[model samples]
Target: MSHKPRGLRPDERELWQRVAEQSVPLHPERAHPVKQVIERLNKAPAKHRVQHFTMGQTARKIAPQHNLAPHITDHLMNNHVQMDRKAFGKLKRGKLGPEGKIDLHGMTLAQAHPRLLGFIQSAHGQGKRLVLVVTGKGKAGTGTGPIPERRGVLRHQVPHWLLSPPLGTIVMQVTPAHLKHGGDGAYYVYLRRRK
Candidate 1:
């Protein structure tokens, strides 16, 4: 068999070694795509990340502050404008059914607020005496974030809203719903009769 060069000559091998050492690698170690994205996000200031109000944030922000006057229905009675004990008892006992019903679940405060106001106004205009407003027992929101989570925001707000200016004029009384009418998740709104 003819003799062949089994290996590179010493001079050629030395030249190849120098070239290999001097040349850049074909592919430098790339940072993982996810890692790169995380790094870029981390470089941003914290203020920018929380710049705008989220839906929950807006809801919590606009939620009516709790008031004691509305709750003390018996103490400061508005006899002419408020529901009488007999009518309120009938409502609480589920003897009187709602003439109309409106569900405010899945709606943010901005949406619910207007919708609630409109419903009350329309119901009053139509001569509907009693109505049901269902504001669901909200989910237990996460409290770990920068904004503290508030539960049952609508449940609290509906009563307060019903007792506020425009709505207060039309709404005669607001009572928690009976078990048959959604219990704690709803309110029995008694509207004033249009003369």
Candidate 2:
């Protein structure tokens, strides 16, 4: 290999060094608007719809299990860019207390299965519209991040279990509750009212 001018001659390097150090400082006036930055990032995901199921599709395709009164269900089924903050806020404030609570902690799927089903039926029979099943934030079962259910075991399986035929009419839809109600750590399980 040819010897590239050994590094640059001192004067050549000095000129480059001076040029490198001279960065036109960011002018506050030229800074990008927050809206512009948000718009650009929002556009990126529109192209990658596979990864993000739009928190943006309000139609039937997005929320098949959405079943409440017509007006109420429509409000809940909103998949706008942001969850309907107002509706979520109201639900959070509203104390639709669970008829009973089940600690699914350390319980294997086989054990929790029947228990969960029975719990739903009892709640439904008792006219319990809301049931709080303590999946324990799904954290104890796996040592993953905050969304503990993403790991093997409970996280991957619970939704399927709930959606199957027996539990199908039992649970309406599961959604992350407001911060006061445990937020993502726990789900607000809306049970179907016994007619």
Candidate 3:
């Protein structure tokens, strides 16, 4: 059975009126623009015409999508060269060999930070110039959230750590390692000369 349309109850109408009076339009300009546009269209001649198109016609191109943030490697490369030009070139080309190396795989943030700090400090203290830091490319995230989550927490955080605080004073430059030395998953940390 179909129900008949009925007017709002007296109490319901009073409540609606009170709500309407207190509510504010989010966009006051937009509220009546549609009505104005409709009134103008009714007063004007229907001169506008739709373009003709066949079913197989090619569609117009859409604007290109906004790009994701620059890659981790890009961020590392963009940093100002803090070491000698010749040495930096060799370092990038994988010509410069690390005097020491540290692997930070399978460790929590708490365990990794201190270990990294100690290793860098020790290397600097021993007058080491170039060292390799291995922070394996992080595992892929499992979440399906709207905001994209980056994989490899250590890969991202290690650079910032090397560039800040007690380590920053001793560290000179940080660059991605070559394939033979675990490319993309490791960093070549150039340290300052021990004073």
Best by lDDT: 3
The C-alpha TM-scores of every prediction are: 0.57, 0.45, 0.65
Q: lDDT of each model, Cα atoms only?
A: 0.80, 0.60, 0.91
lDDT by residue (tens digit), candidate 3, 100-149:
99999988899999999999999898999999999999897764665677
Give the local distance difference test score of model 2. Answer: 0.60
After superposition, candidate 2 runs with Cα above 4 Å error: 1-89, 92-95, 139-149
How many collisions between residues are there in candidate 2? 0
Note the residue pairs that clash in candidate 3.
Answer: 138-152
Worst 10 residues of 1 by lDDT: 68-77
Q: What is the lDDT of residue 189 in candidate 3?
A: 98
| Model 3 RMSD in angstroms | 20.2
Of the pair 2 and 3, which is ahead by TM-score?
Answer: 3
User: TM-score of model 3 relative to the true fold?
Assistant: 0.65
TM-score of 1: 0.57
Q: Between candidates 2 and 3, which one is better according to lDDT?
A: 3
Better model by lDDT: candidate 1 vs candidate 2: 1
State the lDDT of candidate 2 residue by residue for 4-33, as single tens digits.
566778899899989979866668467578
**Regions more than 4 Å wrong, model 3:** 1-68
